[model samples]
Target: MSTAGQEEPDLRSIYHASGPWTGQTLYVAAHLGLADLLDDDPRGIGDIAKATASDEDALYRFCRALTALGMLAEHPGRSFTLRQAGRALRRDAADGFRDGVLLQSGAVFRAWADVLHTVRTGRPAFDHALGMDYFEFLAANPEEARVFNRAMGATMPAAIAALEHYAFGTCATVVDVGGGDGRLLASVLSRHPGMHGVLQDLPGTVSQAGENLSGVADRCTLVGESFFDAVATGGDVYILSRVLHDWDDDNAGRILRRVREAMPAHGRLILVESVLRPADGDLRSVLGDLLMLVVLGGRERTESEWAELLESAGFTMRQVWDDPGLATTRGHSVIEAVARAEADRPDTAHSSPPKAA
Candidate 1:
């Protein structure tokens, strides 16, 4: 089956992978607002450098590299225009990955550089790298926390779309547990005008959420508390969006138990997360699982694993709705579960006690 006049592909070239370099380059551009500047028109490297306060020749080389990568198109002179891929880096673009890029290329990138430590010790690399847990690190550095919050908010659309497909049936009050800045809860409140909402997070995040959710202030209650301690009870629906993935099974189960204790018998729990596939070919979810391991000592779950988790927390799995379109980017799915009957509730006598942060 040999092809005529065709030589064998060079396997050696594959060893010289450039993904990290490309990512770092894109991160530099994103951090410097390079794509944002070129959004309207092409600009010469000198002007771009002036705007970004970078060395002209260095900036020129960067632009040339970006052009080679198809992110920018080089003009006859030393000018460059944004290509289609580059447009996605624009800060103003609705579907922009700018904030996500910045976050990944910053702290996360540094933490991941030492991910082998996590692999060896079964602990988070972030703690090893920064001498503190991820959340604590974020708390100490407010600016980085702001960027992280924005990165989380950017993925809200996927959660919103998943919510649209599910029936929030008879849910008068919806509570978003661990909702940062109230973006997801706000979207839910806006979509269902009749539904009142509760946005719960840390004190700082809840305060910031107040501003983002001001329009629905009359209907939404902002709670600054730990879900590990308690959540506002009596909500017909409770949402844990991208929350459980930040903790190991023990802590995740503890958080779920708190929600269960607060939830009425008729209440439901909606877990918005990337459910891992049994076949293990899903690159996004796999990456996310690894990220959880490296950054938070957590991991993504499979459908069966989710079911088991829910059962242990006194909830019965009802349905799992996934948005296939968002699977590649956000890998979002809404796993709907309801409280088990009083007689069927699991015994929690041996469950680990909650730890104080």
Candidate 2:
């Protein structure tokens, strides 16, 4: 499979050095908004440079690099056009990942520099590199926290995919625990007009949720609280979308227990998280697991691991619905669960309608 001068596809391109190098290049392009500049039409290097306040020649070479990577097309007269792959880098594309580029390439990228510390000590590298916990740093630096919030909110595509095959069933009210900025909840409420929703997160974070919930404002409530303490009660369903994986079993169990304590006899709890597999050959998820290790001291779990965690907190797994068309990162199964006692009990006469707490 060797080409004329390609040297079996070139070791440099597949090597560790090339991975981060490519990432940094994309990071820089995103930082400069190069794709956005060329979004509507082709642009010459000089124009893009002037718009981004970057050096012309340097910008040309950078655009050429992205062109080589198939993200952009270098047209005649030193102009470049954003290619199909490049459109995904746009700020407002449906599958836009621009915020992801900025967030991952910013503080998180720096935190990854100390990944060896996480490996050796089973601790988060973010603490080693930034001298504070990831959440704490976000709280102290409001701007970075906003970036983190947007980046998390950008997972709307994944969230939609995860819920595509799932339904709310009899759940009239849904509570989104650790719901950042209410994007998921708003979307969910929009889909189920009869359903009321509650968005719960840190006080600072929940305050921002109001903006995204304007359309569903009348039917939604925002609660600024920690899951470790309590969750809004009386909801027929509780959602932990991309939430539990942020912690180890100890903390995850605690949070589940809180949700369990709040659930009524007929309530359901849904967990949207990657259930790690041994033979999936999915490197993105593997790297994501590592990212969790280095940045948040969290790890992806297998189906059995999820079952174990749920059962430990007095919940029994009822069903696991997955969207085969979606990726594992965002398309994780809707792990449907109910209180173990609720299922084990012989009588079911105590069911009650969902009520706002």
Candidate 3:
């Protein structure tokens, strides 16, 4: 269809041509270890080929494309070096994002192809497309599992920073409900020497927690149980980090109620998640929202949505903290909600003494 003397371009045709252009380049870079090879200085194509054992012609083509994409820079004759865009490629760098990129490119890239199906059905496309749910799929698949852990690990620092500034105040114990491998718990206990932590998760997950928490073993008690089935009772603070986003509203409310039941009269519930803005203006939050829809059958929530969920679960939303640029490093920021403990329970506080006796 031609319009206004300009031929209408075929949308699908353009997509088809550019579809795998960048992805193929990333795959080539991953295979060649080009970033690691150029970690020192610029190198000619022949040296890079000999080091990675790649064909000279293919290596030259890959490097040229990467250079065009600004991921590499050409020096003198046939020599290339890492550009600013390629800094994340080095594995040993302090702020290296190589593992993060590799993980996204590996499993997530494959799963994201079914976005349309997930959108149509509002079910997890990972399960439908891969024939298994995410955790189950990762359990038996070690490479994918390692990638998942590394990807999660990449966000721990920001999460830790958020927890560091949060007001714990007079709380003696914290139970990390649905804590994955106890990373956040360990980080908290390391910061607060007086506080003790009870780390709870599924039996299969606890074994991994045992390995990850070896350094802080003395400060944490690891429990093996599903959050849906059981949780440790009576902690002053119940921390749910990155847990609620994996569930829908009803299920999320149930999880919050379970935590409330296990809390004391004056206890607090801390929910740490990336709070989604209600509107579509924020591209990052919007993309995260879509990701939740496609992969987890959940959605990134607005502050109001989170407040509603918590209130329905018998907790009042006390406050929400700003995550600042800390969240920008990763895709989302940390939002903490304080849940009131004695709202639903009537008999917790003893009646006041008769006129001060």
TM-score of each: 0.88, 0.88, 0.81
| Model 1 lDDT-worst window of ten | 348-357
- Which should have the higher TM-score, number 1 or number 3? 1
Q: What is the lDDT of residue 327 in candidate 1?
A: 49
- Clashes, model 1: 0
Residue pairs in clash, model 3: none
**lDDT per residue (tens digit) for residues 1-357 in model 1:** 445797765656643334567778888898999887885466888888999999999889888888888889988668988999888798887888888888888888888889899989999999999899999998899888888988888888887776765667678999999998887888888878999999888887799887778778899988899999998897988999989988998999999999999987778788998899837457678888998999989989999989999889888787776755554336788788877674345641111211221
What is the lDDT of every predicted structure here? 0.83, 0.81, 0.74
Residue ranges of candidate 1 with Cα displaced over 4 Å: 1-18, 278-280, 326-329, 342-357
Runs in model 2 lying further than 4 Å from the true structure: 1-13, 16-18, 327-329, 346-357
Q: What is the lDDT of candidate 1?
A: 0.83
TM-score, candidate number 1: 0.88
What residue pairs are clashing in model 2?
none
* Deviation (Å) of 246 in candidate 3: 2.6
Ranking, TM-score, top scorer first: 1, 2, 3
Candidate 1's displacement at residue 196, Å, is 1.8
